[model samples]
Target: MRHATQLARISSILSATLPPELAGHVWFAGCDGPSAVILTDSPNWVVLIRFQQAQLLEALSHILEVPTCTQIIVRVVPEGLPNGYLTQR
Candidate 1:
């Protein structure tokens, strides 16, 4: 499992690498707990990504090799540790 910090890095990379059209149309939004919402001006293209976590990762990997994200959600673990650690444990 990857840490939120690492995920943040991944998100950043993903955000930056998005195609110009996609970049302008898409904006990553609020971190509501473990899930964060992605806002889009072009709903059509974004529809492919809106609720698919796997798609998000796929898009990120294809677009940005190492980009900084605009926003991210860091889910907290019940044991007062980061969720990443909890998952690993």
Candidate 2:
């Protein structure tokens, strides 16, 4: 439905919005209300991006015109796991 489209759009936007240094290391996990969740390949990226969250939110808000995101939640995948695969954490 409408929410599904919104989520997909968010994921696409995030793929392009992440910093080059962080690109390919993270992905859009999903959203809750206006909070956007991102999962990274490693804890290093998680810690790095968490400090840059304000800029990230700003980047996303610029690309997002509807179903606005109000927050960013960054998480790390389990060590030794592959990237971009969804799993219960």
Candidate 3:
């Protein structure tokens, strides 16, 4: 339940921080400890996200009022992807 709350808060942060065009395309999937996972449809979004990672993390840290958010895991999901999706390193 705590994790759910945390992710929801993070989602809010993402929604506000992301650009107008990129806001709704990302979904907050879940998290393990301090690392949060997000889902998006394309690799281009992932690249854009990577470029904006620092700002997102800063926003999250500011909103959460702690340094709990240390890493972001972005998973690209496509219609024809394999049963098990692979996240970029």
Candidate 4:
């Protein structure tokens, strides 16, 4: 299993590259041992991401790949979270 430190590290790195709007939209992202997951909320899309081992990094390499993931999950979050901007890249 992945430690909290590893998850924190990955989350930090992921947060840095996010667009200003997407800053707070992404709740968390990190490696859970050899796997990883990312949580993102948007007005139009509430996305949950999961990957095996290094695949997360590989998918992240192509920004669109992340959003286009076949395993992505989406659902409404009641009142919703803060509004973060995700510039149309």
Candidate 5:
């Protein structure tokens, strides 16, 4: 429950931080220790997000009031599928 809440908060922050064109395409999936897990609807968005990884981490750190995330794990998960499918596969 706490984890989900944190992810939700991060997602909200990410939505605001990302450009309008990329906003709805990216989301905070979860966290892996000091790393942030991200999911995107397309591989194209993954590439774009990676280009902004450093800035995104900094924003997340400042917004969440936590230590800077050490890494980001971005995955492509097609839209309309249940998010849990990522773990299942």
Candidate 6:
């Protein structure tokens, strides 16, 4: 529950950092070591997120107050699935 709250907080911060055009389409997934996982509904958004990788990392590091936030991993998850569906599978 704590981790989920933290992820949600991070998601809110990162969502605000995104371009207005891309805001709702991208979301925080989870963190793997120094990498921040991100999820999007489309492949096109993956490329767009990559374009903002550096900025995203910067924002993440600032929020977490850790320079170790070094990588952003973006994955495509189809929209409208129930939460936790991916993990269940």
Judging by TM-score against the true structure, name the best candidate: 6
Measured by lDDT, the strongest candidate is: 6
> Per-candidate TM vs. native?
0.37, 0.61, 0.66, 0.39, 0.75, 0.81
lDDT tens digits by residue: candidate 5, 40-88: 8888888888877887888888876786477889988765534433332
Candidate 1: tens digits of C-alpha lDDT, residues 1-89:
33455554544555565654554333444345445555443436554444344545456545544323333332322234324422322
RMSD (Cα, Å) for all candidates, in order, is 11.9, 5.2, 6.7, 9.2, 4.8, 4.4
Alpha-carbon lDDT, every model = 0.44, 0.65, 0.68, 0.42, 0.74, 0.78
- Which residue pairs collide in model 5, if any? none
Candidate 2 lDDT by residue in tens digits, 1-89: 55555655555566566667876566666666888787777787877777767776786777665647777788777674333243311
Model 5 has an lDDT value of 0.74
Cα error of candidate 1 at position 72, Å: 10
Backbone clash tally (model 6) = 0
Worst 10 residues of 1 by lDDT: 69-78
Q: Enumerate residue pairs that collide in model 3.
A: none
Error of 6 at 50 (Å): 0.4
- Which 10-residue window in model 2 sums to the lowest lDDT? 80-89
Which model, 1 or 3, shows the larger lDDT?
Answer: 3
As a TM-score, model 4 comes out at 0.39
Model 6, which residues run further than 4 Å from truth?
Answer: 79-89
Error of 5 at 32 (Å): 0.6
Clashing pairs in 1: 12-67, 12-68, 12-69, 13-67, 13-68
User: How well is each residue in 8-55 modelled by candidate 6, as lDDT tens digits?
Assistant: 677778889999989777777777898888888888788999899999
